[model samples]
Target: MTADHKIHKKDPHYQQAKRERYRARSAYKLLEIQKKFEIFKRAFYILDLGCAPGSWLQVSKKFAEDNLTKYKDQYYHRDHYVILGVDIKKVSKIENVQFLQNDFTKPEFHTHLESYFQTKIDLILSDASINKTGNNFSDHLRQINLCLKILELAEAHLKFKGSLVMKIFQGADFKKMFEKAKSVFRILKAFKPQSSKKTSNEIYLVGLQKK
Candidate 1:
């Protein structure tokens, strides 16, 4: 292996992801969430915002594959399931996923999303984060803003019973964000996957069955 690969392999999650053919170590985070909540139980159309390096897309595909028998009766009539990813930066191709390279903060991006799906989505996952500037407070505020944007998109595009999982830094604005999530979703939860680095303040907010 090359030196870079050697270094990456030393990380347990990275090694496991390599062995499992996942795109990145972060795949395990979504997998853990699935294990705890069964978020993909009946999902047919899914979206991944800020999916770069595409690990979450990999996890979504794997979940669909593994649960095919269970969800087939509910979704099999569809000619094809939709798994779309959007990011500001280009992502390497992954089979069965359509990716759009666009900044999601722009209003026009919603048009692209609606045109592609042509229907409300069943699940939306966002692991988007602002570049950390070493100032925790500023970083937290930026991430909170990003989470609110994701919530706006979800409100506009998610089906009534659909779900969302998004990452946000836990700081001053977290409770406000959580309350906003509660207003939009019948069930709201905060989760931190074991795969997440212990030192990181990032937590996932899950909103289920949008109101």
Candidate 2:
């Protein structure tokens, strides 16, 4: 394999964007999905699940800027944006976003989220996945289970008409998962962003108008 081949084999857009902005490649995925779905515009309070590294928080903070940085860790103040990011893994410091280190699946997660927002969130996004074991079936199952838990959490914490975006693998439970999302959200669709590699099974599900 040549050097050029190896470089090109990686996600070209992701690499380019990351180099230019110093953000994770996953940032582009959220941006692409948001651009197509328009779920971020009206969001007042946002929750980012599995939010380590702060890419999703970066995207959301740009949307939630309110000019006053009330939260101590939240540094960027634009005028109306509020962002809360949580993950099991620790993340680097980010201005204009609040970071919480904890497992989101735990009940204690609500305490942090509620304190951050003081109310229900307008948008919830989970770009989380289990460590890939390289076994396609098991990986898919693990991802699906994670998505389900995030969905349940969203249903509990999100305000009416809020939106949710979750990353899930295309597999046996994909359809059932979509159906469950459809029941709670008025609009549900799966999108594969141009930035996402064609070979990856990862697909983003955008749920709008939470019921």
Candidate 3:
């Protein structure tokens, strides 16, 4: 095998210390966004759509633990935090988090939600992506449809002043989706995480302060 060929096969983040510690390159994406947005502060209930192998779930658990620790002295009573993660694929295993394997586009998905929390969710996250057929237009359409369905479910579960963070591609009806999201949430932002490959079109849309 050529040395140049071997170089192309290496996973850049796999050799990095942080990736080894966290077990995922996607973990850095959440860390970076949380650093600036403070998305985890005082968060009580969070819903993770398409959470498999759970990098965001890990970050969220840490946040809840910190919140409990930080307020123990002042509040005298600890608040309970509920975290639920759902994906079409089964999640390996995670502590202090509920994992469900089901298609989010179906009605049964809502049943999973009803079975879990009685109250509204504070944050909703979806890194869900459709299997691409390599046709850009078709891929974008499928992804956009998935994103819209996620938004519908998110809107139903999210509490007043809650937030949603989702992955979207810049194509087809991306602009229209953004505008639609803005109508329901006070703030809308599009962010491309550093962990994402330069050649990829994945962009995270954050809808904050739900109305």
Report, for every candidate in turn, its global Cα lDDT versus the true structure.
0.89, 0.82, 0.81
Order of the predicted models by TM-score, top scorer first: 1, 3, 2
Q: What is the TM-score of each candidate against the true structure?
A: 0.92, 0.86, 0.89
Write the residue-wise lDDT of candidate 2 on 1-211 in tens digits: 9986686567576567667673677888888888899887667678899997877887787756632344334432335567778898899878867788899888777777777888788899988889999999999999988988899888888998899999999999899989988998999999998878778999999999998
Candidate 1: tens digits of C-alpha lDDT, residues 1-211 = 7998886767899889889988889999998888887888777689999999999998898776655555446444344578999998999999888999999999898999889999999899998889999999999999998988999999999999889999999999899999999999999999999999888999999898899
Q: Output the number of the lDDT-best candidate.
A: 1
Pairs with backbone N, CA or C atoms under 3 Å apart (clashes), candidate 3: none
How do the candidates rank by lDDT, highest first?
A: 1, 2, 3
Candidate 2, run of 10 with poorest lDDT: 67-76
Runs in model 3 deviating more than 4 A are 1-12, 17-20, 72-78
lDDT of 3 at 162: 88
Question: Candidate 1: misplaced stretches above 4 Å?
Answer: 1-10, 66-68, 72-77
Q: RMSD per prediction, one decimal?
A: 2.3, 4.9, 2.8
